[model samples]
Target: MTQTPTPATPVHWKVVIDTADPHAQADFWAAALRYVVEDNSALIGNLLGAGAVPAELVVESHGRRAWRDLVAVRHPDDPYDEASGTGRGRRLLFQRVPEPKTVKNRLHLDLHPGEGRREEELARLEDLGARVLRRVEEPSGGWIVMTDPEGNEFCLH
Candidate 1:
């Protein structure tokens, strides 16, 4: 039999969040997921210098330059490009839009608080501005369905 080689592709994935305030969503999600907000200063600077982006469209966030219309959070341990300031691992990108969410999310994240700290973790999340939507139980287990300040759904399991 002949052997075949698998194609090599970078492990890349992003969660898109619809929000009226992308910066606020970035802050809330960064705290909730223990992730770091992407620092896009280098990229933004390059873009501005090259006439790709307008100066009015940039803002300072956490003492770093960021896009005014969108923001992202990335896994803290993931490798990132210091030059471009982009995460190479798990990331959540929040974008601003005028429309409100009208249906249940087709996809959501499950946060594993583990063992018996679910209530404490839930409280912590609430402190960070995540609202409890409901509690769901199943024969196997149960989880708390919650929404970020912007109303994006996530499950604490």
Candidate 2:
């Protein structure tokens, strides 16, 4: 019998969310997902020292330097680039946008805390600044639709 060839490695990518405040969104998401906020301060400092980036394009956040227009959060267990602080695995990047979110999201996250723990997870998320939009009860199952502080929609399961 011949063995089948293994498929190519999946591309590593990150989801990007547009927001008016990237750091705030990063903080909220980091808490909600039990993830870590990416620390790009060292990279920023290096760029600034080399005159590769303008001081006006950076900001002080969490007592450290950060990009004024973007920030990212990554799964706690994911590998990251030491030189750039960029995640090599699961990640979400939030970028500054001029306009606020005016419409429903074309893509949204569905969080599953565990079996029989939706209510507790919902409460925790609410305390983290998530607002419930509605609850859905279908014959198959149920879920609660929520929005983050920036109005990006997500669901709890």
Candidate 3:
């Protein structure tokens, strides 16, 4: 008798982006994706109290203490670590980088608003500090390329 192989489980992850301002990037992305910014204040407080991290390494964002170099946004319906406010599902993490973006991205995100709301969604995103880079139309479909406030590219379809 032959036995079928078991399927492997998928790994959990969050996309990490390098940026000049983590908090600002987090804010923009949170609003754009309808995600919530991860609130790690409780854990930050504990770490501060224990002297595990210095106060100089933290900053206030959205009225909460956040890492000066890192912030994240997560899907609203996903579960997270209560102690650290870390998302266990779909998420994006932004970390501070010394240099600005110098070239086109090797990877980017594509968003689909629905069957007939692309224009509305594009406008909404633009109001949130996204700049339209170009519009592309092809035999298969059409899309608009945009860059975030910090110049990270994403597409609206």
Candidate 4:
């Protein structure tokens, strides 16, 4: 007799992007996606008080303490770990790096702002420091490619 297979469980994950300024990227992405920047000030304070984290590794961001080399943005309605300020749902983590982006991205996000609203969304994104790379029109459909302030590519459909 053949045995039935068990259904696979979904894994929790976050996309990590390298950048010169993690904080700035986090801010930009948060605004662009209507997400919220995770506030880990309480966790940082606790770690500092316990001597688990060095003071030099923390910096003041938006009047609160954050990791000097990394930051994240998450959907506003997602659940998060209160103690760590980590999102349990959709999230994007930006890590600081010394090098700049010099080539095209292997992975990118495609945004759908609803039908008949692509132009409006594109304008809003442009106002947020994104630049139009090109526009693609095919018989099947079309989309507008854009680059964020840091040169990361994304699509508007």
Give the best candidate by lDDT: 3
User: Model 1 clash pairs?
Assistant: none
Q: How many backbone clashes does candidate 1 have?
A: 0
Worst 10 residues of 2 by lDDT: 97-106
RMSD of each: 1.7, 2.5, 1.9, 1.6
Identify the runs in model 4 with alpha carbons over 4 angstroms from their true place: 1-8
**lDDT per model vs. reference:** 0.91, 0.95, 0.96, 0.95
Best model number under TM-score = 3
Residue 6 miss distance in model 2 (angstroms): 9.5
Off by over 4 Å in 1: 1-3
TM-score for each model = 0.92, 0.94, 0.94, 0.94
Ranking by lDDT: 3, 4, 2, 1
Model 3, position 141: C-alpha lDDT score: 98
Spell out the clash pairs found in candidate 2. Answer: none
lDDT of 2: 0.95
Give the 10-residue window scoring lowest on summed lDDT in candidate 3: 5-14
lDDT of 4 by residue, 6-79 (tens): 99899889999999999999999999999999999999999999999899999999999999999999999999
lDDT of 1 at 118: 94
